[model samples]
Target: MTDTQPRTGAPAKPQGFAATERIESPQGGGPGRGPMVGGMVAQKAMTFGPSAKRMVRRMRPEAAPALLVVALSVISVVLMSIGPRLLGHATDLVFRGFLGRRLADIPSDQLPDAAKAQGVVPGVGVDFTAVGHWLALTLAVYVVAAFFGWLAGYVLNGVVQRTVQRMRQEVEEKIHRLPLGYFDRSPRGEVLSRVTNDIDNVSQTLQQTMSQLLTSIMTVFAVLAMMFWISPLLAVIALISVPLSLVVTRTIMKRSQGQFVAQWRRTGQLNAHIEESFSGHALVKVFGRQGEVEDVFAEHNQGLYGVSFKAQFISGLIMPTMMFIGNLNYVVVAVVGGLRVASGQLSVGDVQAFVQYTRQFNQPLTTVASMSNLLQSGVASAERVFELLDAEEEPVTGLDVPQRDGGGEVAFEHVAFSYDPDRPLITDLSLIARPGQTVAIVGPTGAGKTTLVNLVMRFYDLDGGRITLDGVDIATLSREALRSRIGMVLQDTWLFGGTIRDNIAYGRPGATDEEVRAAARATFVDRFVHSLPDGYDTIVDEEGSNLSAGERQLLTIARAFLTDPALLILDEATSSVDTRTELLVQQAMAALRADRTSFVIAHRLSTIRDADLILVMESGAIVEQGTHDELLRADGAYARLYRSQFAAVEAA
Candidate 1:
């Protein structure tokens, strides 16, 4: 059968992601892989409940410490709440003493009839001793309350900081398990935002808002209980304002929730644009698109500003509205309680205490209403993080077949695949590479040359077909086992932040200094590396900007050389270097491929002229296959490709 089967139906596009090649920034901390574009599109606000439960579940390891934080917070709020009531009692004592002194000034027969009828003793003196005792008790309560508050803060900081540290670690680990396709479709900025920004939001909430939330909620209930204990009549009046505050708070939250969601999403977009701009600053200036870039940033920034202002302005109204209701309650309490006091049914001190309680009751309500926005923003951040943690991971559950030894054999039988299945890019294509053979893959852009390499590496699974290595179906082998036998060097070279020696030893970690140096020598990296002052000890920054592009390519070659895999795939491996370096790299490749199976995807047709097998592909189907001489003799697609490149080089 031919490589391609006849079309049956149109291809279906994949959902939730676009088909795009992944781009890695040479600058460190550039846009990361995430779902947002330019990091600025307004995402739908996620529900808070599930995300909250997930975080609580994840933080279970710190349960004991978290519980301790809650206990301390509760004790602190209780202690603080009691301080006001005790001070109120002291006020009552002082007021009583003043009245006693006044009564003492009058003779028993001359005393007011109401006082006499109420059985007030004549010639009574002010009780300074009792007043002093009340003052001391109030001071002690306040001091103890302050101490509890300090202690709670100390314990809570430890718990929150530690929990956030663990959360960051888990998120880092989760990124490694995700599939390559996820990165292919998502922007790097959005991913970076989640790892750094979103996590920080959750961290800040834990540190500043968690204990405060508990304390504010508890304070509300405690103040209400004290109000009831003092006088039920005034307490009932105070209660009327609670429902009013609730209605105001609910209205503000409903309006502000959508704004908060939009605010965070726009923030992410602004970040994405900034990252993209910085990384491609040279390109922006070359194209004279700086103004356009600035305009886009302004648009995103303005969007964020509008939403954030609205959310804050709306949520901001809660405190004042609650305070106004509180003051209104206080006035009513004062007026009615004064009448009761004049009738000797209530003391002036009791009225003062009830007013304080009413104020205290409003304080927590205001804090909680304010906290609602912060909590929502925090939960929104948490949803992004949880979304990443919950992304579909690349599965690794196949049988653990042993890695093939020596030169490897590869075969693709009726391979069918596509980035978006409905738009089939490759169909029933098949090819084979015998042991110790060099297979050269050539095709126009989007003709599935890289896709073929991707399939062979199992970076993606096939829709229909089995690929075999050493006569064993690869599906039966664990991904680790299968990939362990192969080595690759791509056009984009990546190096981590470390000493040169460390990076060269990355592929075969724990490789000796001698072995690393030997591999570097093989790839000709030693020529430039040894000339440097630090030699192999030089530090490469996060982006590897310390080295030139060609230098980075040399290091990656050294890394792959150290692996000594049975199979090697090189996609435009020597495209970065000058002609002189290209010759050196070709020589190195020739020596490396002497007894190993290799696949070379080359745009420079001349480079693969010596390859044992040349597969000239067009639109995902192999149209011609033969050695260089045979292909020129056939005068087909391969010959035309060769003639075109030969003419271009001659003209240059």
Candidate 2:
């Protein structure tokens, strides 16, 4: 996504930057700029690169520890590889010694006539003491090598686990620092997949794939070196398989990488669909669209399966191809080594060692080919993760304009806004709420009542004009500082999964237990809370499903009360509650609104009859405004709305 600069209080035009650049200066450079750059430059660096480059950047400076571990692991693998060859040599030596002993056991008279003619006896043999001493030396070498090999594997595994742990922690921190708008545009499941699934894939790649790859590479080199020491001619023939196997591996990797990318994308899509379905299960059931949702989910599931199958199928071919090449190399080495021994150019021991080296070389190749699939999957996952880390954050820039403390006066001057620029939701809207006054905004759905509030809160910057709090332009103040003085209760109460006391205290985190209960009593929520099984200590389920809608609304109002904010916003807060509960909520609201600036967006005209000023809004603009009696005398839009509500009440 392209990056746009944060708008300034002055009328100067703002400048834009490339998404990859760190916004060091505000749109228009001035005083009161933020301490750090607007967005993370390091995250952007990782966004566009190969998997290896991205992985290296993601590891950060902490990778130094992991690198040291990896180096030690490589050394261990080398020692282990050498150890196996040493053991094989010792086995051959033992066999040869046994052969000599067997010949010595034969009687001198049992010698063949050809042996007698040549003055050679079957019973004659080399010194057993010398042969035993040589065998002991080979066994010692074998034992030492095996010990080092085990040590290497153990050390490397620890390093791999620790490195992955650090990486996961860093990724989670980045996710939290990203802006709210980023979450708005992206699917929850897709974001969650990166944090959960992508990190998991990378961990597996480190723990299993990288370890196997390192061991295989070291073993292959060690075996090839031993083969060259034994028989240079056989080594030369064995080296041919190297390029052949590499070609096969490169082809498989190239084909598998694209499939892996597609597979991960499909997996994310499937996860997003599943999360959407579950979150909206109630709506789906109410609409009788469960079958339709099932069909859509099945389609996504099948798509994921198909892509995963193709990715795995291509990667799965690498192992068999390497094995085929390995078998061919083995036969060639054996035949050539046999011929050389027959020509008396090589000893039987040398031929035996050469054949063993050839097998060892093939074994590592098979291992590396097997690990290619995991490597590809990890690379794909890293690409997705980096994409998120690289996303642009919201702009934060402006001077600190001092606001009047607890004044609670809000004024909009010719303000305009649009969810999309081409379609304005509010046009040239202007209004004012005096200190300690209750302003009620009345309108049909999509009449921009909420949009007006959003602009007032600076949730979205105005396309035109300005919004000021206590005569100070809001755009010039810090968003966090300004929002702190305002308390909002939305129609849909979002109570996090926590104890009732904790949710109430969310409005003022440091509030005492007595203070929390006082706030609850002011909102008339204490009665219901105390009646619960665990009273105020009861744990609410997700979205506070354990409580009725009216109780949830009361809890939200109680939370707002605890904050004791100068400006309180109740946006259709009592719309869903029953009549009796609504009356209780109104009584609580009356108590909470004492000496406070309040804005109530009410559908029921009765709730707003006592408001100091009632604004009649139509199509984003204020059509009429006056006190209840003044508006009723004027017989304007407010009068019509009041009469309509009065008629409805009388009819009921």
Model 1 whole-model lDDT (C-alpha atoms)? 0.78
For candidate 2, list the clashing residue pairs, or say none: none
lDDT on C-alpha atoms for all candidate structures? 0.78, 0.71
lDDT (10s digit) by residue, model 1, range 1-652: 2566433432322221212222232222223332223423224557666766776676677788778867777777777777777776677666655666667767778866545433456556556687788778878877887777777788778878888898899899888778775654446676788889999999987777877777888888888888888889888998898888889988887778777767777777778788878877878888888888889889988999998999888878877887788788878988988887777776666777777787788777778877887877888788777777777898875787676575788898988887655556677887889888999988665455777777777777888988888888887788788888888888878899999999999989789999999999999999999788899999998679989999999999899899998889888888788889989989998999888899998888878989999998776678889898999999999889888888978999
Off by over 4 Å in 1: 5-43, 108-122, 400-404
Query: What's model 2's overall lDDT?
Result: 0.71
| Tens-digit per-residue lDDT, 100-136, candidate 2 | 4556766768854433333333444445565566567
TM-score of each: 0.91, 0.83
